[model samples]
Target: MKKSLLFLFGLFSLWSFALINFKGVPVFSIVEAQQKTQPLTGKKVKTEKPVTIKRNAVTTVLPVAQYPLPKGSQWSYLDNGSDQGATGWNQLTFDNSAWAAGAAPLGYGDPVATTISYGPSSTNKYITSYFSRDIQIDLNTIGDEVEFGLRRDDGAIVYVNGVEVFRNNMPAGTVNYLTNSASIVDGADEKRYFTTYLPKSVFQNGVNRVSVEIHNRDQTSSDISFDMYIRDKAPDYVCVEDHIACFTSIAPTSQTPVMIIPQEHRFQMLFKQGTAYMDGSGTVPGNHDFTGYIPSVGATSSALGHLSVNHENNPGGVSIVDIALNQDPANPLWVVNNSRKVDFSNTALVKTERNCSGGVTPWGTIITAEEATTSGDSNGDGYQDVGWLVEINPATASVVNYGNGTHEKLWAMGRMNHENIVVSADGVTAYYGEDGGTHCTYKFVANTPNNFSSGTLYVLKMDLALSNDEPSSATATWVQVPNTTQAERNNVTTAAAALGGTNFNGVEDCEISPIDGKIYFASKGKNRVYRFKDNGTTVSEFETFVGGKSYPITTANGVVTENWADGNDNLAFDDHGNLWVVQDGGLNYIWVVRPNHTQSDPKVMIHSSMPAGSEPTGLTFTPDYKYGFFSVQHPSGSNQAQPDATQSNVIFNASAALVFSNKDFLGQQQNLSTNPVVALNSEIQVYPNPTKGLVTLSLNEEADKNLKIEVYDFLGRKVYAKETQTTGINQKETIDLSGFKGEQLVIIQVETGDTKQIYKVLKKDN
Candidate 1:
């Protein structure tokens, strides 16, 4: 049962991380266009894209309900010092004409609301602050009870119409300027609202004034906070978690992102790009110009990890960083420690330019792809320097230069504006996509398993005609290019076209599924994810797995229309076999397709969204499947810093990688306490694990009446599928692998109503 994908509202509780969606902006708009308003620097700006509305297209929008503050509740605040405190300060007649004014939540230590003119520092800060606001209310149209939704630090006392209505975290009898709060408040708890109710009789008919005195727990406290609102009644309540992901500035040097590490009671600056402070110690400063961060762990159990970041500048390169978790005693929170840059110059890597999205091998190395088709050849090796896949060893910080004296370019891969590469689980086969207007999808089969230096490259020539209006598939044949070296042909694009290679529209990232062992690649121009079936030597089946040219477009006037799903790039998969795709094309969305999803049932969900003009890239998941990492790249530069009242406090379009826990997207909270585990049943067995032709499937228990069997090749294409009644109990059946007689791996899946099982079968002979 497949379901069409729709843009889903982020309905998750606010943890340390907050989700932000900056929709309908393009990355290139930053340089060419400008909003007449203040500087954005990397913020959202709405753009009008030409859309042809189809009467039949219906956009599915998930409505989110929020209990927000009513209009005109913002307060004006003044810092109260020991010298200025007076007995009548809480009264409306108090002379406070010289006090400062700002929007509420007037507090320190949070970026979400307007800060009061006071202490983030001990010197310029005051221990207590006084706030007052006058709101006009009609007594005839009001409820009996008034609810004050308040956020404060340490303690606060509220007075309405010169009467003490409520006091929280304050001493019982007497509260003075010098008195401290009864308890200390730290972290996000400071932003929590402590609701206090009072009778409507306490308010006047018109121009009623409310005052609040906020006192810190102590003078030496690191932060102070306060915010509140008055309502006739508590708002229509709903536990809708619309915002769950946190945000950072587009450029990290300006403001580091604050993240709450999963399973830990703390916050940390996970890592920042495009900054001068190189290492976590702040002692060494290397090029802070790194982007497209891909996190890698050393082993299955290690929290300490390494990051391979792509430098997107034209003269760009890749930087490797070593990162570890540290608990800072000052805050008793987890922070990133000793982030050292792994040097790669001494190796054959003299230069790597315009490095963008790449892949991580099963062997634990980073394959950084250069997203260039034409940059004058820099290596003096005849071929251009920018269209190659440069593999780097994270442990040793060495580039696999193939000993050609320069970081060896895999010229045989036939790159034309190469986007990214994905290797099959079998390791001998690799798939890559081209990010060009008329590019072709290609693959390479290594002569030896896991060895890419020597391989036969083939371009896919579809057996069926292609169209942009609809999703299509064909049994494609591989056309092997003769000259495998750049020195021989000098132009891989021409070499690929010389074969019968069919053209695709803007092929982006090619992702090999860990679950189905098939290849899924995104094409921006075509607006579809193409699925392929790869045996060791060639791609046999090619088709659109999900997505098409026309998708439901949301208009500015909130109208549903038909539009293109433009900018589909950077594909990833979680352990659950859900394909998570990010857009580079201007849609600014992160979409997910479930494992059993079909083309008709577009069960794709818009998992994450960003502000307009920012494209999401480098979507990855940790080996433990605990956190998913992605980045918002090259946002609009106008109005990037000002607080958008509608957005989360942490919302910004800074070029930063965001980390979200698996549970945040999966909507299963208990999984947070435990690591995700993939358990295979030992009860089902496939004999001749590395079978040459045929394999026997045996189940320890009785087979259900109707059994479903499926076989997928390395490229994730279904080669064989059957639904049949099996012998009643402990039945055995033989699956013929003779058709797939090659040195490649095939995934066999058996599903019953109650149980499902998967097996990896290696076909080794004729």
Candidate 2:
């Protein structure tokens, strides 16, 4: 009977697993079960036929629906320079049977589907041209909101079902056939399509009429074009886990540009250029580039931190902002609390120029790289001081002040077209690269740990010959440069080159791999990323990690092809040790190279594509690795606007800072032990499993014993450990894991005297 019950239980479990449903229908079902009994022996036997279930078709309803009046559709047009008084011509009831018919766009002076006469002479053209189309709509098939994408040169007035809808570029009040456009159509705006929404109530159930009149800025405007498309107003994109694969690049248009991210990730625009600071210091500056996030002291909230943003302008400044995270699950957003700009007027280095890519030190300070160099000695210190690393205290939102009138500039590090710097975990060793022309990679070792005021600077010198045309490998060494005096430091670049420093082309960024502690940097001019094991005084296994060769890339349409031309620029590493390369010159694609990728067969994937006229800069991840921050610099103003994951309208037509993460993978909480009750002793409990930063441990039962708490990462690396005495019946302890990188699994071991228990916990970013 026990054996029979066990078999029945197995059948029940299988049935339970098969009952899981998608869209209210069971994905699979078990069928054909039989039981036979032996009468003489009074025994029962069971047998089942092979189970088969039909997979049901699942349908998806898109948020938007296009109307029949798509762009390039045939239209009835009148361009004979004849004036039909406004009323009769725009009404659906008025029939123009004699009007010439042609497929849009219909105009002159530019490419069009059908060329129309521009009046009698080239200098005296028609002022107005009328076009109309009939569209069929099913009320049940579309939403109540309707939108129109209209492209026109000079000016236009659109009417739907004889009702005036919208007017563009034309003066207010009454308009006639001879009315001129308010402004001349020129450059990109002339060919750009403007979008507007209207009520679906303007149309009947079946046939609807859309009429448009195009008017030139002047009688002899020299050009006129018009084209339009209509669709139900709804969201064009949705972020769903495993549902969408990727977002492709878009061209410059009047519409807003959308960010290209993995389909599963959710993107939010935290701040934009020109945003007013809460402190009233000033609005956020433009030409945004580098972004560094510094977690606040004892901060448990994922959103609460200091964010430093670099302005890459002639007179650049770093903006420090205080941010907080919203806890509402339905509307998770990072809120900017306050902001202020770093002051530099009082220091020897009166001002900073072209503040570009920078790094956050291990000891919680921001070091902004001054990318532009000047020959003038403004401080009269016998050395040019414009191009140097300036340290800022984010908490104070000002430059770190030394004694006298001097400020935060690291004079010993030398000057060049400094792109970015990366400090090692020890905070003593730093690596940086130059950004323009023929530059060299350099390293600096602080005389004392965590202090950059004094350091021994060295330039990289490789043994093997380096070439820009092909992949190169070599063993390298860091050769010391003469930096004992200010003049020597100012001319460090020249001295380094004299010491046989390998002249790498445009080294844009440098980063340290979390998995292996190797140094990686991007040579934008050479189109490659190189990695080397920094063995203190020497380097080993120096080779190109990615780029400089053809690698397979999957296009948005699912076609795989080889792409050899990539101008790799910025570099970042995720918790999983994947190197993310953001391109600046070629295709502007963000590529992800796996940790185990080999030079012979590089394992790379196209993660994202930037919009036209824009380059991605400053890619950095939070400690939990659940979120990342980056900037879209100098995108075309004509890029279209799109709705973000929260249904908020966002436009990337200008420089902006954005954050993104995988939606489904965010805010997940787990305990360390397989069974919390057994391992935690029932009396011990951990609250707020998926913590923003702070975690609390509570003990309810009475116990007088020595308690030890420890945390270990997946790699068995001890990240945190603490010990205390439990003197009372109830005890509580708070653990701060805000500084850990990426959303990761860590084991927590709790020991009370001879009894020890382990629990698995998931640390996340919000």
Candidate 3:
């Protein structure tokens, strides 16, 4: 999510003149299409071959498929938080409503917030603060061209060899609009470059400090969300065929490298019907049941559905906290009846995060974040409190908490609403999303990094590009905090500062294209998607896609965008050069957006939607690309007493599991559809996909002389690239894939007038 294209009006308010009429799928039926095909007036329908434009211009349009689900093949419904029992449980309740109950030592159950913070984040005594740290990497493996990105609210800064790569410092408050809330390092903001280049030598063998600074104005006080990590591979490092999918049934036969969600570590994902469930159980691949508590309208599979609960953000019946928010056992995970059986009677508990969503670690573990501070007492009543980041190990089936500095600090981070984690290509820096009306995105730079305790944290900020003169969209800059104890860490929390704050739609899930170091994110609050390039600077600018609700849509400028509303959760690119977007199950439907990245005027080539209740969560492509996996966690528990099935669609209405093909989104490969029609012909094509090294093709074959080779994004915007000579036929050419990331697309178009052709290619394992 980026900044709003509108300017500000009042102080606590900014007003956009007109609601720009921005835009907008479906299934099939044999009886439907045939009826239309049947000649109403059989007048020998003259078949028209028309003109033979032998794919004159081959344009490669990456095909999108439904995000895969975890193909656990057989996941036993566990009840315990350990690895042992995987069966039924008698109605059981701990019979306690106290805060941080149980005999466990309260807090995040980790080292107290002494002095050091996660990353190099600074803390403000008055209201804001910062804490910073460093992560040393081997530049040898990570070429000098290493690049990544960060997401923050008001501002941020990333440096390599002390050379600034990213920076931004927006205000506080919050922006709900997607385009207005997201900030990438390139294009949009001068200080933030999307594709920043860091030479291999930039990182010495020993230690390197990755510092961060944040400011907090009076409004909501101060707190920063920052993540720092490093990876040696590019965004496309995981080839389409190699990158595991969103859903399938993988856990049972998961060949995809594993990551653990340590015991006690809070972890949750939308499975079916947008229902939320947590695995409070010890570890993964265990005997003890990981199935813990489920908060919903009710906790039954068929009978009463998991309707709603009155939580902080979710009022009425609609739910918000589907996933757990913390990892400490002291917190009661007791809840239930949302899975296969409809029974809120038995009070089963699970783990959770601190508002910040949990993330899968490179080591195959799940890291749950607790958005609370060390001293707990977010209201500042002076009561002992707790906040920290916890880790859940799948192998060991255990959980550990990494507490925060202060309660207000934890609460300021947005009270257990942590939404995303964008890890670095090498595991040096990690970007975080603070989902809230007055929250900012942040980064965590681990000290020993992989070992934890070392590094700094930085906030996200962007310049107001659309509003030149207005201070709201001022120069793109990323403010820095020497330590987490600084005086101002909420600098970017302003509606204007953080490009409209976290309003219309706040940043939910963020991902980067390893190939070009481009960043993409979903703004659930806004129902939009955005892009950011890496050019070396604080991230602020973002390209966008206004994918309409459940429909294939294109921008007036010709570029295609993805769409969603409260369309929360994950994002990823497949080996086929396609971008897959996942929405919250409860959002009413499933949508897949396919944009012709190679087209000059790219349009959404495909769009598909499914019925309600199919709550989709987590996504992964199998290593073989033959299968995919995602988690459709069934709903559980109800605020009221237990309700039987006759009541309503209850929890099951929010539960589901899905698995579709690579072309599922386009309805091309899939046979079933709510409205499947011979969709309009797309202006895209590609070749030698899953190639070992080079790939080539042309936009139009009519050109007798030359073809221009370039790479574009979903919005049809070209990024840093070069041209090459094609063979006599439409300028045949080859590009070195050694420098590129994962399976990506390269466009070759004819220079001869308006002639064009498109081709799709894949760069993969040799």
Which candidate comes out best when scored by lDDT? 2
Q: Residue 726 of model 1: what lDDT?
A: 59
RMSD (CA, angstroms), candidate 2: 27.7
lDDT at 211 for candidate 2?
A: 87
lDDT of 1 by residue, 1-766 (tens): 1222221211221111212221343322322232212121122322231111111111111111112233213454565465434566556566443344433445665442344545445654576788776567677777677777666788988887667888988889976777788898764346445566677888777666678888888867767767675666522211111112211111111112322122221112244454443544333222222223334553463245666666565655565666543333222212344344434443234466567778878777788776775566644656665567777777666676666655665666655677788887778888887777337788878888876888887778764335332322224567786655566435667777777677777778888777657888888876778786666554544556677633332222342333326777888886557687777765566666666554432344455555444566777665655445566665544424432111224433445544554233322223322322112265567889888888998765554456788887754556778887656556787899988755987878887654566677889985
The list of candidate 1 runs beyond 4 A from truth reads: 1-269, 279-299, 325-334, 338-350, 375-379, 401-407, 469-473, 536-541, 549-564, 637-653, 662-766
- List model 2 lDDT by residue over 1-766, tens digit each: 9988987786666555433224454423222211323222223422222111222322111111237455555566777888876547767677654455554556777655457778888888889999877677788877677767677888999987788899988899998888999898775455445677777887778767788999998877778888776876533322111211223322212212556665556677876887787788778888778888888855233567888889898778888878776786545667788888888776377788999898989888899999988768866767685888988889998787755465658888888889999999888999998886338899999998877888899989875346333322235678999888988888888898889888778888999998788999998777778888888877865666777666655445554655646677778887657788888767777677766565443566776666667888888776766677888888887777776655577778788887776663333323435545355577688767776677788876446678888876654445678988776656888888888778977667778776666666788976
Cα lDDT of all candidates, in order? Answer: 0.57, 0.71, 0.33
| Worst 10-residue lDDT window, candidate 1 | 50-59
Rank the models by lDDT, top first. Answer: 2, 1, 3
Model 3 scores what on Cα lDDT? 0.33
Better of 1 and 3 by lDDT: 1
Candidate 2 residue runs with Cα over 4 Å from true position:
1-256, 299-301, 403-405, 468-473, 554-559, 562-564, 665-766
TM-score of 1: 0.48
lDDT of 1: 0.57
Which candidate achieves the best TM-score against the true structure? 2
lDDT of 2 at 380: 77
